[model samples]
Every structure is written in structure tokens, then in C-alpha cells.
Target: MTAQEAEDFLRTYRSMLKTWTMAVAGFSNDDSDLLYRQLEADQNVLADIAISYPEKSYSVDLLINSRSRTWAGYAEQRLPRPQNRQS
Candidate 1:
């Protein structure tokens, strides 16, 4: 995908997120499915753009990538398995 397309996709995602968030006021299966599909589609665009050097701009994809790394670290540590106790 070109840079313009990537930017447009992020804008569409933000618009969809805002509409669902404001309209529903909470999570819904429909919104979840929409978000998952959007993310999956955007992932390919992101991967394609990764090979090219960025053009000195702060994009939503870049921020989201950083945030995902941070979230992954915290999430992995948060869900530890419980140890079995001796009878």
C-alpha cells in the first residue's frame, strides 16, 4: 500500500472506532468483529510500508506499534499461571 492509502486506512479506523465508541458506549460483538477485520487488513499495509524509510512524520501506525509492544510486555506478565499445591 502507498503512504496515502495507509493514512486513509488509519483515518477510517479512527472514524469507525469513534462512531462505535460513542454510539454503543461499551464493547459489542459487532464492533469487535469490525475492529478485528480492520486491524487484520491494516497489518498487511503496515508490513509493506515497513521496508521503506519513514518520511519524518508521526503516524498512528507508528504510535500503535510502540503501544502494542508495551502492552504485550505488560500483558504477558499479568497472566501468570498458578502453581499446584501439594495435598
Candidate 2:
């Protein structure tokens, strides 16, 4: 992914994570808020990395996949892939 694509994926994923974190009726706000804050901070840090080294897509991808397999699954479907050289 390019820097712009990484940022876009982060934006979209953040929205989904926020909804998933907050939409449960039984979960306390404290828990939800804490989770959201932590994830948001991670997103910010990753965004910074993408911005600082736009060519380092693999680095950002590695961090994200390490952080959340659920996210990585979605990302595999959503993020652009390198075209096969022979194709």
C-alpha cells in the first residue's frame, strides 16, 4: 500500500473499530473509552510512520498485522496488492 492508501485504510478501520468498541450495551463506558483511546493512539502512531516514510509500506503493514488479525483479514481484502510480474 501507498502512504495515502494506508491512511485511508486506517480511517475506515478506525470508524469500524469505534463502532465495535462502543456499540455493546453491556460494556461500561470506561472500558470502551480506554480501548478506543488505545487503538486511536496506535492509529496516530502508524499514520505518523506512514507519513514519515511513505515508501515503508511493509513496515506499517507488519505493525498493523501484528496488532490485529481481524484487521489484517479485512485489510487483505481491502488493501491493494502488488500485481504479479508475469501477469
Model 1: CA > 4 A from native? 17-30, 56-63, 66-87
Clashing residue pairs in candidate 2 (N, C-alpha, C atoms within 3 angstroms): none
Q: Write the per-residue lDDT of candidate 2 for residues 1-87, one digit (tens) a residue.
A: 566766676676656465543433232344544555666576666767677776755666765664455432332244554576353
Error of 2 at 84 (Å): 46
Quote the positional error of residue 61 for candidate 2 in Å. 1.2
Candidate 1 — worst ten consecutive residues by lDDT sum?
A: 67-76
- Give the Cα-based TM-score of candidate 1 against the true structure: 0.41
Among all candidates shown, the one with the greatest TM-score: 1
**What would the per-residue lDDT of candidate 1 be over residues 1-87, giving only the tens digit for each residue?**
666776676677566655444333332334544654666566655555544526513555553453244222222234543567342
What are the lDDT scores of the predictions, listed in order?
A: 0.50, 0.56
